[model samples]
Structures are given as C-alpha cells and as structure tokens.
Target: MIGRTRLAVDIGGTFTDLVLSLPDRTLSTKLLTTHDAPDEAVIVGTRAILAEADIDGSALDLVIHGTTLATNALIERKGARTALITTAGFRDSLEIAYEHRFEQYDLYMERPAPLVERDLRLEVPERLAADGSVLLPLDEAALRRLADVLRAQRIEALAISFLHSYINPAHEQRARDLIAAAMPELAITLSSDVCREIREYERTSTTVANAYVLPLMSRYLGRMREGLAGIGVTCPLLLMMSSGGICTVETATRFPVRLVESGPAGGVILARRVAALGGYDRALSFDMGGTTAKITLIDDFMPQQSRHFEVARAYRFAKGSGIPVRVPVIDMVEIGAGGGSIGRVDPLRRIAVGPDSAGSDPGPACYGRGGTAATVTDADVVLGRIDPSRFAGGKIALHPALAHDAVLTDVGLKLAMTTDEAARGIVEIVDENMASAARVHAVENGKDTAGRTLIAFGGAAPLHAVRLAQKLGIGRVVIPVDAGVGSAHGFLDAPIAYEVARTFLVRLDGLDQALIDALFADMRAEAEPVVRLGVPTGELAETRTAFMRYRGQGHEIAVPLDNAALQPDTLRQAFETTYTQLFGRIIPRLEIEAVTWTLGLSEPHVLPRPDQVAAPAAAAVVIDTGRMVEAATGETVDAAIFARTALRSGATLLGPAAIVESGTTTIVPSGFAARVGYGGEIIIEEKMA
Candidate 1:
C-alpha cells in the first residue's frame, strides 16, 4: 500500500522546518523563523516545498506541528497579564517554593520569579479537608467581588488552585463556573485540571504556567491553522506534545504548557526509532540546531521521561533555581550552544559562549544579513570545517572574510590570539560544553555514558558529534539520512495520544477496588476525545501507571499496572519489585500507598522491528574535499571528504575525513573509522589500538 501523504512542521528558536511525505518520496526545507508572526515562515516554506514537489497542498491528508513559542514566552517574560486565585490562606504557595535553596552554598543565590506577581495573586474563602470534604463552604459573595477586581485589572488569563483540590475538584470547578459566568472571555486553567497530583507548589506552578501561556498559544495556533488553510491545505492538524505524543490542536490550545520541550522531544523520538531500526539497545540522542543543543539518554529503545521539569534556569545546573513546570516530558538537558549562539569575551577577558542566541533575524555574521557579532557558525567557517560555497545546500553562500573579521575583532583582539586560534577556542569550548552536559545528565539519572553510540541529528549535530563522542569516551556515532530536518520527520511518526493522571492516595492493604476502577474509567473518558481526534478509526491502546512509594517518602516512583481487574496483592508485589530496581532495596515494615494514577490512550504503534544482520566491510577512497584545521592542533590539513549519498552499505571510510551531506557534515577524526550499516546508518567506531 502506498504511504499516506503527511506534513510535519517544527518551529525552533531560530528556524522553522517543514517535512512533506509524498506517496513517492520525502521533501524538506529550513527557513528563518518569523519571530513576529511565527507562521509566516511556515507558510512560505510550505508553498515552496509543495511547488518543488510538483504537488498541491490540498493533497495532504494530515498535518502535524510543534513549536517553542510557549517556552520562549515564559523565558522572555512576555506572557499575558495573568492572575492566580487560590484558597484564602495559600496565596503564598508560589512564593514559598521548595524552601531549600538548590545552590545551598551560594551566598547570593536567587529563586525564579513567580509568573504571576503577588499583587495579582488573589485569595478567596474556601477550604477542603485532606479527604476532599468541604471544610468551609465556598464564599460566593467574596468570589464575585474577586471577579470584579480581576475584570477591573484587565487580567487576560486566570489560574485557580484550591487546597486539596487534587483529591476533590468540586471547589475548584465551582469557582471556575462562577468565573466563567462573569468573565466568559477569560482563559482559565485549574490545578485540578492541569496537574491532578499532590504537592501544592508544583501543581500551582504548573497551572499558573499553563494560564500564563494559554492565550498566546491559543491565538498563535489559531492563526497558524488559518494560514495553512489559506494555502489550500485542509487536513486534521495535530500538535506534538513534550511527552513524545501527539494531540489535537484543541487539546494543545487548552494545555499548551506541555509543549515547552516539544521540539527536542521530536528529535529524541526520531533517535529512538533510528536506534531500534539499527538494532542498538543503548543510544545517546544529540540534536543541535541554530539556537540550542539537546541531549537525551535512550534505553531499551525508549526515551527516558519525567513528570517534573524546570525551565528558564537562573543557574545552569541548580535544581530549584528555575521555574518548575510539572508536566509529562521527555528527560533531557538543553543548553544554548548551537550554531548561532553568540560568542563574547567576559569582563575578566575570558571567552564565554551563550545562553543567548542571535536567532534567525540577522543570523550569523557570515550569513551577510547584518549580524555583526561572531557566532559558533561563523567560527566553523573560519576554521575551514564548513565549506562556504555549500552552506545550507548551496542555497546561501557564506563570506569567509566576514567570519574572519567578526572572530578577530570580537575574540582575537580581546584574547591576543589569531583568527584561527579564537575560532578554534569557540568551537572547542562549545563542544566541551555539550559533552559536559551529557555527562552530568547521565550521572544524575544513574546512567552510564561511556560506551553509548551517539545518534546525532538536526542541522548542527553532525558537525560536532565526533569531537563530542571523543570527549565522552563514546566509541560510535550514527548520523541518519535527512538529519537536518529530523525532528519534523519524527513528528510524522508520533502517536496520537493523551495522558490523564489524578491523585487519589490509597494504601495497598486496604485498596479500594471500586474507587480504582472508577478513577481509571474517568481518566480514560477525559483522554478518549483527544485521542480519537487523530486516530478515529484505529483500535486505541491504553497504558496504566501508579505512582507509589513508602508513606514517609516525599517523592513517588511510577509503576505500570494492569488496567483490568488487578488484585491488591499483585499490585503490591509489582510496586515492591520496581522499588527494588530503582533503590536496590525495599523498606520493610513501611506502608506503601499510591499517590497518583495515570492512564494514557493512544493509537498502537506497529513499527517494524530491525532485522538482525552481520556487519559489512569496505574500502577507503577520497573524492570532493575541503581543508580543515585539526581540532587538537591548530595545523590545517586536507580532510578527506566523501559524499554520504554516494557511499553504499558495507563501505568503510577512515577518519581525518569529512562525510558530507545536505544540511550537515560529519568530521571523522584520525582515530575513528566509519562503517556503513545495513539500515542506512553511518556508524563511526574507534580504530583498534
């Protein structure tokens, strides 16, 4: 059967990528992201690619999209005027976040500012018991007055979180009803709806964050859909969630906070798929684009995931120094070390790279688009790693002299170094920065990074993967086909799904079977409409997980549970087994209780398994080439250059060579040799001693 025609769009900080899968082939492109409009770039690229493929946009049966607009809005503090309505005495929950400083030893450490200011955080008279019983009746008169204040203040969005509302959403739902009656135009998010788990601070933070970005996301998505429709493409539009799942545009408009890591999450999903196809059990995903780099660890062909993550960190590795958004997300470490990351000299005359980026407006100095400052991409050109004439598949030519001037003036002058030396420093430092991040992420998650194969993708990853692999002592690397537009491609393969979770504390000894059944049913009901929107005719797959731990523990671990009639004894055994795997021991004499239950509904993935086959052998030959400086030494030499498309399977190539492809280049250093795998993967291995 012919494949269905699909299109996937991923909007990054610096670029908007489009991937169109026609019945016969795949087409892709990258264009500068229109920060002001965001969808303008998508429309232009869509029209261009569709015309290039000699097809009309109306032929598309589906469209998938992922974007960083929500994440950027929160980090830049550009969200709408938002207010938080909480139980009367709990208005300070956001201010009293975590209590312990993430950087305990620092004398001047600061916490992330709350998205909603104290003045805007209003209080209403309401109380609920630990069991979700109404301790005090909700004061409707007080809520009406608060509604008036909110309207007078011109609040665009509102977040409502009442104490113990996770267990009983009655109070929160009533407040929402009252607020809607008064301000029907207001965008509101409830903690009970956004995050139905315990922990007031995290739940409130998540809800407030959702409300903060709701209006912006809703408007942007609406505009984007209209823009796409105007171009003759009329199909079901899906949004990629940070949890590596796809949902309808309606679901995305309601809970847009789940999209903070959606772009990177797509790359991880692509990596996992490639690894499974290549028969690799362990792989490290590295995605480097124009404005940021992301690294994730994949085990057993699944990307690691988490329910809690921090954003906009004030301190790079400090846990509590960033705003926490408790939503289901793939676990990864991201830093501003991409091609367009600006390089600067600190006050101490030391070289520093970003957390800031030039993005796509003017781009790098070499783009000849008016960017004056030096960036990582400019440095690569100066060092000869990038061929000026073939940058961006020859669509845009780079100016070598401009790269030299920018690096020399911005870095060489301050450090008393040559253009080559400064460029080398910038390049080496960023590689080290990415490597260091990968190491830390692995160590924190109790994972080993020593021998994992680096599955690299995106526009800039292949350019740096080799050096990064050497730094982390990795022995192999895989650069897949169409690596430049990998994330957008991954979006085409994502499952249309939604996860629903609720907090209902229950001990195993006295497990309430009836309550468990009802809870799961309700969650499934909530998720079904979202899932059916994308997979209307397919058999839905359901997954169940319970967050369990010792009663005294502050955090819980997720354990998979049978959705059918599960016995209490069997559930206890499963939880204990999982606890042992994570902690290596089970706490004796401790009562284990489940704090949160989750149910996920999605279209079942029927991906083909990789064929286990023997490795192939090859020969070394040189073709088109470029002169590049050795990263270890400043000496320039002839780096062997070979076209990735020309090399067939089982062909072996040596290091000190450049594997050239569209959108990216893999530098094979002297110590490594690449072997082509049967699955179209370029596997680089360390040469034998």
Candidate 2:
C-alpha cells in the first residue's frame, strides 16, 4: 500500500508545483508561491494534488521536495541576525574578500555589501597550523566572553571559523562546544564541518551563510513536517541537493546552504534524461522560469559539477562579484531573463530586459496581479504568440489589452514604434540576453554551443526555444511533455543519495595508510544513515572520491577511489593517472597530496530504456483543422493546434504548429517537424535543406 503513491514538489519564485504519482496515473497542480509563509503554498498544493488524484496522504511512500527559500533568503537579506566567531587576526576576513575587483576597467564599480558588519564579528585568540597541528589552544574564558558579547547583542545564530580549521578543526569544535554550553538556544555552524575546504574566505563565507539561514530553515522545515504529519502523511520527506542528489530532511535542515541551487539542478537532471531519450549525448539545458533562466551543459548524461558558485553578482555576468560558497554544485549559468522580467527603454532609446523581476505578488501587467510594469510575458501576449484564453491550461486568463496599453504607454509611444514592434523588441532583447549567457557559459567550460542540442524546459522555455536555437545556430530542440513543471517531474527520477566530505590532509611523500583508512571510514559512516533514510535496507551503492592536486597548486581535482581496499602504491598510481587526465600532464618533481575525501551513497533506479523501445507505425501526416497563424516570419502559415494527449507514439506533425497539453505548450517553427518517441517524449528535429 505504501508503494502505491509518491509525491514531489518544486517551489520557485513565482509558482509552487506539486505532482502526485499513482500506480497508473500522475496528477499535478500549480499554485502561486506564498513568500510570507513559504510552507503554506506546499500545504495547499499538496492537498489539492492528493485530492485530485483520489489518494490519501497516509498511503504515500515518498515525498521529494525542492525550494528556493534558502536562495531567496540570502539574496533578499532576510536571514536571521547572525554573528561570526573567528581567530583573533581573521576577524576582517569575511569583510575583506579576495582583494580583486570584479570589473577592473570600470572606475566606479561597487563591491558587494558584506553580509556581516564589523561590529558583530567577534574574535577569540586561537591558531592551528596548515597540517592539523595545534599552535595556540582555544581559550574557554575568551570564548565565554565572546559568547556574553553575542548574548548581549541578541545574536540569533553564530558561525565558528578558525585559521586552518579545515585541516585541524579541533579548535572550532571546542569553540562550538563552549558556545553551546553557554547559549543553549543559539544555532551554530562550524566551517570545518560544513565545507571542509582550504580557501579561508570561501569557507568562512559558506559557514556564515549557513549560520545566517540556519534558524529560518530549521523553523520552516519543522513546521512543514508537523503540518504534513497532522494531515496523516507519515512518510519521510527528502530534499534535492545542489550536487544533483537527494538527502533526508535532517540532512537538509543541518546543511541548508547546499540547497541554494537545488531547484535549478533538478531542471538539469530533466534535461539530461531527455537528452539520453532523444539519442543526443551532448546537450544544453535551457530553462526559463518566472524569475530566471538557467543554462547548463551535459555530456554522457551527467550535468557538470563544480565546487564553487557565487550569488548576487554585482556585475551580472562577472565571476568574483558576489559571495562565494564552496560546496559541490552543478555547474550552470543563471541570468535574470524570465516571464516576469520587466522590460524598459533606456535613455539611449534601446530596449532592455531584466536583472529585476516583478515577482508573484505584483506579476506582469497581463496577470491582473496589481503590476503596472511591462514584462516579457506581456510582450509575448501583445506579439500574438501566447493565446490569452489558453495560457496555463486555461487556469489563468490573460488580458491582451492591458499588455498592449502597458507597452504602448511605457515603451512604444516614446520610441516612435508601434506596439507590436516594441513587444518584438522586448522579446528579442531577452532572447539575446539568454544567448549571450549561453555563449559565455560554453566558452568558460571549453564547450561549443553549435555542437550541442538544445533541451528546453521550464514555464517560458517552449515559447522562446525556436528563436533561441536559431540565435545559437543549434540544429535541434527537444521539448518534453511536462515542460512547465519539468523540475517537479525530475524529482521522480532522482535516486536516494547523500554525499559526505571531510578533510584529511596527506602528503603524497609521507603516505599515511592508517590515517587514510580512518578518514575514509569516518566519511562512509557519516553518509550511511542519511542514505538509508530514503533507501530500503540492502539496496544501496556507493562511490568514493578524493580531492587531490600537486603539492603547491591552488585548486584540486576530484579523483575516483577504487572499491577494493587501496594499497599505498596503488593509490598513488591512481592519483597520478587522474592528475594527468585533468591537467594534461603531471608535476615532474612535486608530490601529489589529497586535501579532502568524499564518499557518496545512492540507491540506484533504472530509468525507462529508450533503446529498447519498439518503433511505432509508419508516420502519417495529419492536418490540424484548428487555426492558422504566423509563427516566425510574420507570413501567414497554416498551423495546427493539436491536443498532446491524443497524439500516440509515431504520430507526426509538421511545423508551424502548436502542441497543447495539460501542463505546457510546444511551438514548432516552420523548418522543423515533431514525432512522439517510444517513451512519450516529443522529439523536434530540424529538416535538412
């Protein structure tokens, strides 16, 4: 009975989506997000989905959730009042970030505002060497004095970051114990336990971010659990991770910092799976939601992973302009181009789309949500691309007149252009913004956009995929059935997984076997319980990796560890091989050292195999008798609007057509054709000349 039902939820800036899976059917619903109380949207959406599916909450086997709350909290500066406790001379480390300007050429470029001001950052005298050797012991009296200062200042949470804490952590641990003994109610985060990396600024910034959001995330998660239990849903809730894995609620609440990019990671997972289904090994995932558009590259069915990501960039596309968090995250580029992105005309009379959005409360002009600003969606409606009566599966009717009036008054009349021209300009500007982001991301990763097929998803992706693909010179596009709720659907395909990282400094010359074994064992032990919470007994697999580099290098690369017990020499050879593969050559004289080790456990599940699919009947051209419209060149073209549910496998249709489904809409341009594949995915392939 428990295996008969499952639930997945994804919370975005403008919408919260819920999906319920029964044995034979899936039901989904979308609701406006409640920013004031984030869990309220989850409760409402979950109830609606379960009711529509005719299932009781008690029968659910699993609940997977992803949300933007943590990311929003950091961006809006709405986290808890937090203080930092650090070694004496390092009090200014968080404030004084890497002393490099993000924009070297601009004379007036401003740096990102520090999260924690100087007054709140208290110092305790302690030091540790880079090799885990204790230099100056932590002073309990000094810690207590700092604790008193924090208490007097009414700090709600505290972060403990010490010099060389990733290597030793003894001083940070002792400081945490002392702080907890003194202040029982204050939440605490230790840098060594959270990140366990070597960069001082990045590690401390990550710890501070965790501490700042700890209280808020803890309270929200606790309330959500209680609410779900009150409704008789006794199943354990798991959360998606930024590293493209899933972990238990306890793990999420303990390390909420890792959830910052979780939602976008889900979209990447969907794109990768869709790519494999369509027989494309190299693909670009393009997701344009209500507040942002994320672009990620995938090869061999895996999204790229990175150990560093920045948020709230002062310069939109600059790398070093924001707070750096060193965690395992899927590598992607996020730009502020989305449905709710506001469009305006600059003083030079050039049209510009957003780095600012009219969020759910005051959505685009056509939503009737009290917004007066023109947005991308409003532009689409005015350009005759979106049907007002059929938007969002007819759930919300849009007003075209309001969109026209907003654009004409704000942008059109001033620029001496017609309303349609202004709307087209807005669409073109956003498309170029997204294209520029994709180009930059590919260049940074040593990839070429022309060689990768575009896998488009998210609420606004289908509306613009054709134009976007054309801009990038990409030859093919694949739009899945549930593109609007793609991230939520991706949750169903995720395996139950967890990753544990710990610092165990080992110089390759020394080769400490006993220490290496103990460190790996500790990491595995820490990761097992979290993995077991989602997976049943005796059905789990694990992967081991060590972060290694040359002796004096600034960064490290992840090397795979063999499942069999590692002999010292064998391990050294493995490291040498991995180093060469990553850097093209190994260091001739310097030794290789491992600074950190990670162990990941996952209960693997098989996705539906596409290669095993039986080909359907010979494709037949079906004429759509609904309506005719211009899709691309503004020339009248016969377009068919077909119901996606009625199209079976092998059903083919030519372009300029609109495929409408319950959750999303796909528009095929004039030069392409679509066919339903074996697994019910809509595959859009470009026609040859």
Candidate 3:
C-alpha cells in the first residue's frame, strides 16, 4: 500500500503558502497574495510547485485549504449587499446590539453599522416562544409583498432570523422557502441553520454574516475547483474551519462564517500537535505573518475553544466594539501586528506600531514594490536582522537603501533620532505590542504566561520569538520545522469533522434521560453525514458536551459527558466538577441547569511522530556571520549564522545567532541559547546568569 500524497494551502493577507507532502518528503513554497483575485495566486503557486516536484496534480490524493478571504470581507465590509428578515418588532436588533455602549466613557464612540440597512431590513408577522411554541402564525401575504421590495432593493443575499428561531425554526424555514421560491438566484441563510443556540443578537449576526459572504465564498470555491481540475487534479478538497477541523467544500460554502479564523486556526492545530509531541502541558501558540499576529493558549494539548467572537473592532480593539458572530472557533486574540505593520510617531512623539498593515499589494518599504511607508520589515532590514539578499529564499530582492530612507523619513526625522535608533524603536514597539496582547489574552482565560512554553511560527514569528518569550517571562521557545508555512502544514494534520450545537434548557436535577438522549441522537445524525463525506468507511469518534450554569447566572461553562445514558445525579456531579475547575469553587445550594448541548463527530486522528532531525553531531560548531543589531539592546553584535539544513541533532549555538531557513529565520537574542532538539525543533532557552 502506498502512503497518501496530500497538498495543503494557506492564504494569508499578504502571502499564499503551499505544502506538498509526498510519501517520502515534503515540498513547500510561498508567494505574494493576489488580493484582487486570491485564486490567481493559488493557481499560479500550485502549478509552480507541481512543476518543480516533477509530478502532475493527478499524483495528489487529497487537497486541504484555508484562507482569510471571508475574514477580510467582513472586516472591510466588502461582502454582498445583504438584507435581513425578522419578526415585526425586531427590525433594529442589529443596530441596537447589546443596547449599551461598548465604550461607555467615550462620547464619540460609534458602533459598527449593521450589515443590512434599515430600509432593507424587512419584517413579517411571525413569532415563536422560547420553548418552541408558536405565538403567531406566519403572514404569507406580507412575506410575498416583501419579495417585490427585495427585488427593487437589489439585494444579493437574504438572512432569515425569526424571533426564538433557535428553539423553533419553523418560521425561519418557511420564510426561506417562500423567498427562495420567488428568487431562486438569491443566496439565503437562516439563523437556526448557522447558530442553533440562544442569544438573539448573536444568532442574527451570525446568519447575516453568513449571507453576507455566501456569494463571494461560493464563487471562489467553485472557481478554485475548476482551476484544480484544469490542472488534472480531481482530488477531494477540504476546507479548514475556525474550530480547527476540516470539512468538505460544500459545508464551507453553506456556512462561510465558520471560515473567518480558518487560517489562524490551522496554526493552533499545529501547536496542539507540537504540544502533544513534546509533552508540553502548557504552551502558547504565536503566529505572525505579513498582516496580522495571532495568539492562542493551549492547555493539555488542546487550544481553548469558544462559541462566539467579534470582528472589525471599531474602538481600541475592545470587546463588544465589533460585529459579533457565533460559531465554534478556537479561541485566540488577533491583532494587526505583522511584518507589514506600519510604524508611526504618535502625537506624544512615542513610537506606535499597528492595527493597520501594508498588506501585499504595496508590501513594506524594503520590498521595493512601490511601498514607501516605514514598516516592521523595513525596520528589521535597517537593523540588519534580515538579509536583503536572502529574503523569501532569494525569490524577491530587498533594497536596503529604500528601507533606510523610508524609516528615516517616516520615523527617524519625526522623532529627531538616527535611522538606526528609529528602526530599533519600531521593532521594540511591535514586539511589545504582541507581548502585551499575549499577556492580556492569558489573563482573560484565567491563566498566566510565566510558566508556559512559547511555540512560534509564521513568516515573522521566529524573528522575534525569543524577545517575545522573554517579555512574557517565558524561558523556553520552540520553532518547529517549516515554521514559515506552519499553518499550511497544520492543514495536512487536521481531521475530517463536524460539530452540532443546539439549545436544550433543562435543570440537571430535572434532567429526563429520554429527552437528553433524543437531543444528542438528532445532533449525531446531523453531524454523521458531514463527517462521512470525508471518511466514508470508518468508526467516527464522538464527543458530547453540555453548557451548564447555576440557575439565574448570565453565562455557562462546558461540561463533558460520557457515552453512557444520561443520569441526573451523574450529570450534576460532572457539572459541579467542571464549574469548580473554572471558578475554583461551586455555588452551594445552587441548582445547575443545562442550556446548550453540543455533539462533535470526527475521524479518529493518530498523531504522527515529530519531525526527524539529522544525524547527531559529536560537538557543536559555530561560524560567525556579519554584524547585526541586538533587538534586546541597542548595540551591534557579531551573530553566527547557520543554515537550518546544515544543523544536526544535538547541535547547540550560543546567543546572538541566526538560524536561516528557506521560508524564515530564527533569531536567538543575547543571553539566549539555541539547541537542535531530537525532533528537528529549534529549542531556545534563557541561559542562566
């Protein structure tokens, strides 16, 4: 039997990464992203990679892909013209989000505008109670009248989210049928279908988000498939989801909202595997690409998961300042801090890194692609941290003079400092920004950063990994093989899976075995077909979880359940145990109630062994490279440079060293020591004083 040949592709804001895993070896490449037409880069890169490997696309058995297109559409408000259909009295639900200001003290605080305008937000006479009871009949005549309005408004997509539809989706379903019958070409989404849980605002937001991006994602997926077919590749193509799982392209098209964090989620999956392989119980995953940086916390080899997240924050990246979308996602904090992040002197003459990026079209000042703004990459180049001759493995040349001029003009002159000082300040500010974000994320998750191992990857992460680790009080850092295209590699490791969540409120003490059993049965039935599409002949793994809380509490915590039949006493004990873990104590005499149930089905995954290192060497050898500025201090230092391909297992190099690879470079700052682990990982730790 021949091992499978798989291909994985990850599309970031500024680059499209491809990884081809043959039976014996893996080939990888990185290309600048084509923002106007993302699939263009995918096709071009795919063809180039295949040609280099001397194989046709037909040699591939499977293809997996993850992209940031859907996320960018939501953040830039570039999706289709969408409308929302809701109950008569709830036309303004989106605009009236949370009914309170996310930034209370700021008088000029502005909430994100709803995707659907008030003029296009049509309503009908229909209502359902919280417990799936019908309060009012559907007004067919009114809905039929609204179809003409929709046509006149030229809406490209529609979102149907009737009141209380999470419990009873009859009204929403009927509305969709009627609208689809009238206009078969229009894309339609239902809150019940996308988010079958409580919280009216979140449900509607999710459905609207789905409808908003449906047309764009559908067309892109279809075109991508056709392109692959043109290259003689007819393999099954799976999409990475925000929840760190893979699903067929069909599911992704139907629920594009789930792909918002797909690209970043792959990095988290890779971190989990690394965590498990290295036996690191607590690890922090850091991914920094060209346009954004993402931080995820992992515990016990599992990245934290969430059912809700916001997009396009309008105020200081505060919670509740962006549009909320409810979906199963690997919880992470993302900020606009990347290689292309622009640097500027704020009003106080203090250096400020970004929440804005240059992206690929204009790139950074060093790319010499018509970009003049001072960016983090430009700073790195000015500081001599990146080799102008070796960036992107010599695919693209960097102009040091351009980097120096841009940084000098933008930051140096403004701050009355030398170009080198300004460059150092820029790198320092960006590093601090990422470190602060990681710290805040940890605190929010009831954890701290001191004792965790930092796993860094992506295009820019390895460049600043040691500095970031030091700032977080971390002593250990690991850079896995192929760290630059880490997310693409992660795509190859994802499992075929689907998850179903539904609202089923009931007190643990009043839990009826039959009712709970039926609920899970239905959820399992729904997820089975989705998972089977990818794995047709196997016993799928199953997991059950319930969202439980003390009665009258505003939020709930997830409690895992066994496969056996539900029992009130057993469920109560489980709930209490989970609650205590999260809160450090359980509420005495408080009744525990289950509000939501989730069922996940996936193909069992057997983790592969860590990357193989080269033959062990008798002793470490170091070669001094040219001088470069140490980021930790403002002084120049002589750094040893080693090609990653040349290093053998058990090799060690002292601080002020650079490990260069095809895709990225790992910089070991002063006071740090780098060792080649047995698993081909670059393990950097702080040396004892």
Which portions of model 1 show Cα errors greater than 4 Å? Answer: 347-349, 562-569, 613-623, 633-635
Residues 7-105, candidate 3: write the lDDT tens digits: 899999989999999988899999999999999999999999999899999999999999999988988899999999999999998889998888889
lDDT of all predictions, in order shown? 0.88, 0.83, 0.90
What TM-score, computed on C-alpha atoms, does each candidate reach? 0.95, 0.93, 0.97
lDDT of 1: 0.88
lDDT of 2: 0.83
Q: After superposing candidate 3, which stretches have Cα over 4 Å from the reference? A: 1-3, 608-615, 618-624
Counted clashes in each candidate structure: 0, 0, 0
- Per-residue lDDT of candidate 2, residues 82-128 (tens digit): 99999999999997898888899999999887778889988988888
TM-score for candidate 3: 0.97
Number of colliding residue pairs in model 1: 0
Which model scores highest in TM-score? Answer: 3
Looking at model 2, report the run of 10 residues with the lowest lDDT sum.
Answer: 622-631
lDDT of 2 at 371: 88
State residue 588's C-alpha deviation in candidate 2, in Å: 6.5
* CA lDDT, candidate 3, residue 305: 89
